[model samples]
Target: MLSRLTQRLTRGSGELREAAAAAGELGPRAVSLVPALRAALGGPDGGTTTPDLDADTAVAEALWRIGQDPGPVVAALDSVFVRAAQNPWGRWAGVRAARAAALLGPAGRPLTPRLHPLLGDPEQVPAAALALVAVADPASLDRTALAEAVLDAARREADPMGALRALEALGAGALSPAHRRSLAALADGDARVVRSGVEDRIIRGDETFRNRARALL
Candidate 1:
């Protein structure tokens, strides 16, 4: 399986990349594919998909699944994120990078500052929020401020699900009656908002974050 995925990543075709991504979705069992996934994130070929960002995100997701040590993956992704952020060319690569950084969890703690501001990014707010959830120290997180930023994202049509999931992540201590009302309002307004309620179970982004809003908000 690892060999096949690696070959597909190297081949740079959509079908090959999809096959590789399916194997990667298998999680830690696919740990050996980490090196190949890393290469695909930025290699000259790098499984360049229609947007290129798609492949970057796919490889990053696989690394997040199996990666235990933040050592190299974090640094590499930060490099790509920094470069993409400095320029306007990257579609949503920076957002995906932050998400990958979140996947690193504790090791990714150092990247919180960079990830937080992007919660406002219209292009990929949900992914940015996901990153924050994965890396927040909880004790140190400014829940009030985080809530404000995330609520703004949820209001937008682009990726409301991201904010919905982020809302589920907050604890009762962080939410006031108004905040809860705001969430309930979102729940009532859009059925797609409830999409987060269902897909949250798959651990699409993080199992720990699954169904957070559905249960909490």
Candidate 2:
């Protein structure tokens, strides 16, 4: 079954077509497409070298695979980041780092300082930092520096999703009253979908977070 699925997914039409069609018809078996999706994204023509439809599809596909298997997803993302760093569009490296960070499983953390260069820019730093916090061993993080970075990212990022991700990584025990207030404010943003799953985990008592947010225009 896996071999047949793999062959079907890697066929000429692209994994997205197979993934979507399988998702619509095969139900749970569609999950098998995840690895193929990542494979295609990180493939020679995976789109990491250029920001085109194929690249966008690769990122989206990788994101889906992360939801399915975060460990492999993080590894794949790490590869993408390395490739992106080597590419001509190296400036987008932070963005790729941030995306990789977001995909990391709770136990995954980079021991190498590859992400440090991007951390200097608040706009670029928070997403990558938040992803680090999400996956890093708390003992591994430099608490003082990470706290400062999170605050800076929260203050500088206009995107609610970015702020929410950092806040979620800060977690309930780590957050101050001010952070809670900021998260509450984000409940109404156009980017609420990005915060939904993570925020729902945070505001465990607030069943209304999901319902009220859903009513957004």
Top candidate (lDDT) = 1
- What do the candidate models score in CA lDDT, each in turn? 0.62, 0.51
TM-score of each: 0.70, 0.53
Model 2 Cα lDDT, one tens digit per residue, 1-217 = 5566557555344454444334325434556556565554544344444343334334443444435544554554555566565665654554645554554456346522556556666666666667666666768767446545655554443333454456556655665566445444545444332333466564552334434423321
Per-residue accuracy of model 1 over 71-156 as CA lDDT, tens digit each = 55565555556556655656467766766676677778777777766765765666776677778686777777667667767655
Q: How many angstroms is residue 49 displaced in model 1 relative to the true structure, after the best TM-score fit?
A: 9.2
lDDT of 2 at 127: 65
What's the residue-level lDDT of 154 in candidate 2? Answer: 47
**Candidate 1 deviant stretches above 4 angstroms:** 11-20, 43-50, 86-91, 189-215
